[model samples]
Target chain A: EAGVTQSPRYAVLQEGQAVSFWCDPISGHDTLYWYQQPRDQGPQLLVYFRDEAVIDNSQLPSDRFSAVRPKGTNSTLKIQSAKQGDTATYLCASSFPGLGGHTNTGQLYFGEGSKLTVL
Target chain B: AQSVTQPDARVTVSEGASLQLRCKYSSSVTPYLFWYVQYPRQGLQLLLKYYSGDPVVQGVNGFEAEFSKSNSSFHLRKASVHWSDSAVYFCAVSIDNNRIFFGDGTQLVVKP
Candidate 1:
């Protein structure tokens, strides 16, 4: 089975520029997430969606970052007026909710991630 | 709110030596724990997970994690280190299935 897919693998941009990252999750997966991983750090959740409804996005930067999953299968994360601090890897992950018993410890599948550099 | 802590920023060990990476969590109830590894330029992969049942859970590549509810910890260990095992390891916790909180990560270096 194919895993989560994301693109472009890398992106370089200047300050104030805008960029978008896309993600295609595994088939039948109901939960999709976007995370930002700074160098030498673990991924920080930006937003997540269950089906077409957003479950949580409190950590997301409302001014510059936005995400949407229109069809509940594919998602896009867009950054407006990117800054140098935005330089990090954007990771996309998916999971089957409530698959692992009551605790729902199901594994998450991630994509290769898009490395963004804002100069 | 649930959170994960990986105190070590980096660790180095000779090949064939034993390895252990520490993780601690803060939660009100019994939490779901996971260990994930990220190789260079690759996505994070599941090493193992612990929800219930046995405290010790085995994962791929000889990696194992022991979950302690009393101590609020889920530490990863391996009997012997391999050069290929060098990667960043993250500990994550979740009270519910919707959100997961990850640690700062620990980078492991296995010397030849």
Candidate 2:
């Protein structure tokens, strides 16, 4: 099975610049997620979508960050007017409900991630 | 709200030594827990997960985790460590299969 695919493996931007990371989740997976992973730190959930409907975006910086999964198969996370603090890897993950042979286990499959550098 | 915690930021073990990575979770009810390992420049991969039934669950490459409800813990363990086992491990919890949270992760360094 093909894994999650993310585009622009690396992004370099300056303060106040804007960038968007794209992701194509595995085939048939309905749930998609966006996470921010700083250097040497684990991923922090930014937002998630079940199909085209967003489920939770409480952790996302609403003022500058936005995500959309128009077709429920692909997603894009955009950061407007980026800052140095936004320098991190933007990871996209997808999971199908009831995986791992257990009901609603939700085992996540991650993409290699798009590394963002804000200077 | 549900969250996961990995106490150890980093752990160093010699080859062939037993290894354990601790994970604690906070939730109102029993939640689905997981352990994921990430190799250098790679995405996170599932090592094991626990929901109910057997407290001890086995996973790929000789990885196993024991769930303790009383302790609210699910710790990953291996009888022997290899240099190839060096990687970052994350603890995660899912509530209602919609919201998921991950711990900061533990960096495991296996010395040869």
Candidate 3:
């Protein structure tokens, strides 16, 4: 089976520019996640979705960052006005929901990630 | 609130030597713990996870982690490491129905 896929492996933009990262999750995976991994830092969860609805987005920078999964299959994360601090690898992950609501499949399969460099 | 900490920012070991990466978490509840690895220019890959049951769990690429409730830690271990094992390892913790929190990460260098 194909793993989670992301487009534009690398992105370079200037401050105040806008950029978007796309992701195609694994087939039949109900949950999708977006994470930001800065240099020498671990991936930090930005947002996630269950089907077409956003499950959590408190960590997301509300002013400039937004994400959507309109069809519940593919997802896109956008930054309206990128800043130098936004330079990081953006990763997308997917997983299947488990029988119990609290217990998910507990495994998150990740993509190659989109590395963004904002100068 | 919960968080993860990886004390060592970098570790160097000779090839064919045993390895251990320390991780500690702070949470009031029994949170789910995870270990992930990332090769050069690659995304994070799951190394192991601890939810319940056995304290020791095995993962891909001959990696294993032991969960210690007393210390609030889950450390990754490998009996023998190769040069190919050089990478950054991240420790994560997640509460029920919440997003996963990850540590800064530890870079492992296996010198020949």
Candidate 4:
């Protein structure tokens, strides 16, 4: 079975530039998530979607960060006017929902991640 | 709100030595716990998880974690450490399966 896939494993940009990271989640997975992982830190959830509907995006920076999953299969996270602080690894993950409104094992499959460096 | 804490930033252990990584969580109700390992330049991989029943759960690569409700802790352990086991370990908590909270992670270095 194919795991989650991410594009542009690495990106380097200058301040004020914009960039986008794409993700292709596993087949049949209903939950897709985007996370930002600063160096030496764990991943912080930026946004998530379940079947094309955003479930939560409170942590997302409304001014600069945006995400969308149009078809419920693929997702894209964009950063407008990127700053040096935006330098981090963007991780994408997916998981299948369990029955009865609860999670089954709660295992998340992740991609290699897109590492961004804003100079 | 649910949160996870990994107090140890880094730990070093000799090869073949027993290893233990500590994790603590804060939640109002019972939480689904998980331990993930991330090798250099790789994404996080599930090591093990605990949902209900049985305080101890076995994971891949000879790893196991014991969940303690009284102490609100879940610690990863291995009987013998291998050099390949060197990686960043993250403890996570899932309240509703929609979102998961992860710790800062504990970097483990196994010396041969």
Best TM-score among the predictions, by candidate number: 4
Show where candidate 3 strays beyond 4 Å. none
lDDT of 3 by residue, A9-101 (tens): 999998999999999999999899999989888888999999999999999999999999999999999999999999999999998877775
Residue range with the least summed lDDT across 10 consecutive positions in model 2 chain B: B93-102
lDDT of candidate 2 over B45-71, digit per residue (tens): 999888789999999899999999999
Per-prediction DockQ comes to 0.66, 0.62, 0.64, 0.73
The model with the greatest lDDT is 4
Clashing residue pair totals per candidate (backbone < 3 A):
0, 1, 0, 0
CA-lDDT, candidates in order:
0.92, 0.92, 0.92, 0.94
Worst 10 residues of 2 chain A by lDDT: A97-106
Q: What is the TM-score of chain A alone in each candidate?
A: 0.94, 0.94, 0.97, 0.96
TM-score (C-alpha) between model 1 and the true structure:
0.95
lDDT of 1 by residue, B1-112 (tens): 8899999999999999999999999998988899999998788999998889999999999999998888999999999999999999999988885688899999999999
Write model 2 residue lDDT over A28-113, tens digit each, in one string.
Answer: 88889999999988799999988898988999999999999998899999999999999999999998877552334468899999
Name the runs in model 1 displaced over 4 angstroms: A99-105
Clashing pairs in 1: none
Query: Docking quality tier of candidate 1?
Result: medium
The docking quality of candidate 1, as DockQ, is 0.66
The order by descending DockQ is 4, 1, 3, 2
What is the C-alpha interface RMSD of model 1? 1.9
